[model samples]
Target: MSESLLHRCPVVPVVVIHDAAHALPLGEALLAGGITVAEITLRTAAGIGAIEALATALPELHVGAGSVLVAEHVDQVVDAGARFVVSPGLSVAVLARAQARGVAALPGVATSSELMTAVGLGVTEVKFFPAGLLGGPAAIRALAAPFTSMTFMPSGGVSADNMADYLAIPAVPAVSGSWMVDPGLLAEGRWDEVTARSAAAIRAARGSGAFQRVV
Candidate 1:
């Protein structure tokens, strides 16, 4: 796992690209805004192509594959040049596959049991998914109480308004979200809007003063 890639950007753009052509422009916009990571989800048909495109076009950007639900998905992303892999939920098969492949896998965990399972798999950093619905910062804080060594990347419901709150938690190392880089905007080829939104979100996350308070 490349810890530097995970920490380089406070907010990772969780993107679902329907067009492979839009990948490069969207990636450039994100990088321009001081964000170096992009997670191209396989939720769309063109996902694999988009991931390959971004990896080729934006070598400086750290590209990852998201919504990886199966073992084959992990192989697909690795072959597509994904630097990391993210799953919506943790599964023994998924973790084992990722570990065997030697890629950084961030499995989603929303409960204490899930967190424990991820820890058992030797994952130190995890994704606290559906964060807003799962009690958000309060839930994370409570979960971190017993597992202080574990950190999280809170996704789902993360927005500029509350990004600081999530980052303020000592258990959170970073966050992943789609609010900054809207799929509609990217689909519509609105690169400028995406760039601006990415910049705003990055500023909000970094300006929160939370990174300095990590304990």
Candidate 2:
């Protein structure tokens, strides 16, 4: 896995596009805000098309797939041009498939046992899913205590209000959430709003620069 994958952007927009056509404009908006990474989720049927559109049209954006639950999903996104794969939980099959496909994989780990399993698989990075409910930055700090070599990206319940807090942790290089790319904003075609929120997120990340570097 590329160590710099999570360091490309401080806030990776976790996007869910209901319409594939919205993908390009959204990617452009993210770029306008100085964010260089996006995680287009597979929660919707248009996910594959969205990933392909962004990957083909906006090669500058480090586009990745989120909410990947199976090995087949990994293959689908990779073929669709995803550079990375993110799951809500650890899955040996998903990790193996992603490795076989030669793409970076970030499997979520909310427990020490799960993290140990990831380490066993030679994973150097992980996503701390449902970060807020899992004790937020405090949880990551505790987890990082034993796994000194591992780095993390916190997602779920993460927002601008507490994003800086998460970035303060030495183990977290970035955080992922949907605030900048809200479903309502996408449905309304509010590209400017997306850009504004995305810019704000970038500023927040910059302010909390302690963990901005790759671990």
TM-score of model number 1 = 0.94
Show where candidate 2 strays beyond 4 Å: 210-215
Q: Cα miss at 157, model 1 (Å)?
A: 1.0
Q: After superposition, how far is residue 12 of candidate 1 from its true place, in Å?
A: 0.7
lDDT, candidate 2, 31-119, per-residue tens:
99988999999999999999999999999999999999999999999999999999999999999999899999999989999999989
Top candidate when judged by lDDT against the true structure? 2
lDDT of each: 0.84, 0.91
Error of 2 at 101 (Å): 0.7
Compose the digit string of candidate 1's lDDT tens values, residues 1-215: 44534566788889988889888889888888878888999999989998899899899998889999999999999999988889989888887888788878888998899988877877888888999999989999999999987888899998888888988876676888898678789877888888898888877776776445431
